[model samples]
Target: MKVYLRQAAMAAGLLATAGLAGCVSAGSVQDPMSQPATLVPETKTGVVLDQLPPPARKLDVAVYSFPDLTGQNKPGENFAEFSRAVTQGGSAILIDVLTKAGGGRWFDVVERNELQALLQERQIIQNTRTAALGDQAPGLPPLRFAGISLQGGIVGYDSNETTGGLGARYLGIGGGTQYRHDIVTVALRAVSIQTGRVIASVTTTKTLYSVAVSGGAFHFVAVDKLLEIESGFTRNHPPTLAVREAIQLAVHALILEGVQNGSWSFADKKAGDAFIRSLETEGRAVIPVDALEPIAAAKPVNPPS
Candidate 1:
């Protein structure tokens, strides 16, 4: 009994020491337990979106819907809940992305997804004017027509695409880091309103990564008792940010393909580095390469014999 009591007391003392370490330490100005939200001058999307130049001519575009085709939910280790894996307001996010493409100079979007509500509001205004002044109130201007339609949805989501951990244990005292990766994919297409034909299509993907570094100790304090202690920090990439990045990449692809096919042209030539260098940063493709070689025009492999 005496030996067991001593072991219990020693474990308690070690835990108390750790608790004290977590408290305010020498020269510390703030509580160690609290952390503020990270502040940044600009969002990653804004920084990249701004790289595209304002277009010389904007196209009238309409969007009827952008739905989440991936019906997956947040994966749970214990019990699955009815929560979604991605944001429900995906259509709104897509709309904002369309507006920001080419720095708000690309698409003049018309609100057709809520066509009935818009019409009801317009009708109310028209009737109120008619009731107020008998007959002739120079009618409201006609609603603008769209020349193009943008459509698609979040098509795929994979959970735990990759997961790994590295750790070692000696006498039940150990530390390790574990990481997981998830992926999302989106597909977008533009259609010619007049012809009802698909004009351009593109797809993009974003990866979400999470990592945790943890150290823990477990020990037996008595014949029938055990003690355990653990501390760690985990970081997860925001899923919404992943969605935004995927959509942004799709938009970048659309603009470049359109320009290459002569669907539209940039107004300011000097300010179009962003559009010209799709998936590029600082004047080069974001692809990583160790070496490069310029190639001369290659001879035809073999003329069709």
Candidate 2:
């Protein structure tokens, strides 16, 4: 009996050490609170947006608002919560995408989201100039007008669209992993400022994944003595980043749709046609992974005699 307990204690210690090593190697043990501020990491969709062909001429565009229409509350396992599931700064994300599209050669975005504040500031400048210089006061140049208005919003936030897990245990030592999937959708449209017409529109969707990994052991270290140890980590993909990717993809689609419908043109006809074909092929490859089916539980392992 003493020999059996000694062996079990050694096994538990080895299992615990291995779990700690795995977590550290995976780089999931660091505390993010200690990190310095950094620019948002670029996503796959953002990369494609940057690689798009230059437009024939930069279009003046305005994004007045991009509200969250879904009204989804953050999902919780135990209780209700008032916090929203998605970011409220959808307009800011859209504006940033427009400004960065095609390496800043696609669109000139105007400040329409805060038009009132801008106008007030301009008025203050004009009044000061008039008071100081009389009729010789130089006037502020006219505010640039937008030729096209971009309108859109985060339209959907579906939680727990897919969930699954797999686990195994042996000799009172084991590990398990679980994952959950969510989807976010965005829509964008370009409207002609003068014609009151929707020139182009596109909708895009992106998936968010949350995963957890855990390992633990329970063993008798000595007579009437027990040892228990657990190690694990959970990773949740930011919903805001998911929303940003969706918006970026929506912008990319809108640009392509515009080119196809003659609402816009590219700088080089041959290069543009080739680019369009390549992106269409890439678009079809963004299918979501299958994670809906629950994994079968692992059967217990018979202890060594």
Candidate 3:
């Protein structure tokens, strides 16, 4: 027993020492938020939007606001924290996603969230020209107007809607994995500015998954000596990402809905038909994980002249 005890202690000591090296090592990439950052969507809906073809003509769309309607806090071990369940800058995220859709081929979004600021800036520009060069100053371009208006906000945020774990133990040494699910819902609608009619509406939801893994060991090396060690890692999916995904899904739905009803069209007729056919097939709704070879094969190679 004493001999086995010494071995366990030595092994555990080695593992603990090795783990510490990660703390001081200079990694190839910096961890998230080590500096200023941007929101990136990584969901199936986002993937679909990226794969979809761009519209033949852009639509003028205005988003006045998309604030977080849910006032929930982050769940704590014993109590909730003050941190919000979703990002407060959801409007900005939505705009970014809209512009990025179809490789920046979706909508021409107007600036309406900060109307007063925009108006003030415009007034300053006009005043500056008049003050500097009298009446000969060049006139500023007119502000663009939206044909359709978008409305709604992040309607809901639910945390720990699902939670589970799996583990095993042998001779006081054990390992385990746990997972949790959170969801966010967003609602959006498009209304005609000229007729004041609601053209389309969509409600979409996204689920955030979190996973944690851990390993631990414990044993009695001697009658009076004992040893224990634990190591764990957790990866959390942000709720904001989920929100972005829901919005992307909604936009894709809107595009399909419009095209099907003749509300819009693609510049090329065959491109439109191919896109519609792809939408019908689930396989084409997203770009394949290894699509380079498949895409190359689909396109005929030109013979050398």
lDDT (tens digit, per residue) of candidate 2 on 1-305: 99999999999999999886666644343633355669989998899889888877788888999999999999999999789999999999889988999999999999999999999999999999999999999999999988898897999999999999999999999999999999999989999888879988888899999999999999999999999899999999999999999998898878766765566767775676666656556654221122111111222221111
Top candidate by TM-score: 2
For residue 138, what is the lDDT in candidate 3? 96
Model 1 lDDT at residue 171 = 92
Residue pairs with clashing backbones, model 3: 5-221
lDDT for model 2 comes to 0.83
On the 0 to 100 scale, the lDDT of residue 22 in model 3 is 63
Q: Summing lDDT over every window of 10 consecutive residues in candidate 1, give the lowest-scoring window.
A: 291-300
Clashing pairs in 1: none
Which residue pairs in model 2 clash with each other?
none
List TM-score per model, in order. Answer: 0.74, 0.81, 0.77
Query: Which of the two candidates, 2 or 3, achieves a greater TM-score against the reference?
Result: 2
Which stretches in model 1 have alpha-carbon errors above 4 Å? Answer: 1-46, 218-227, 270-305
What stretches of model 2 exceed 4 Å from their correct place?
1-33, 280-305
Q: lDDT by residue for model 3 over 1-305, one digit each (tens)?
A: 99999999999999998886565454324533254556453777777687667666778888988889988777787975999878898888878878777777878899999989999999999999999999999999999999888888899888889999999999899999999998899988778888887777778788899999999999899999999999999999867677778888878777665554455555554565566566656553332324323332333222111
Better of 1 and 3 by lDDT: 3
Whole-model lDDT, model 3 = 0.76
Higher-scoring candidate on TM-score, 1 or 3: 3
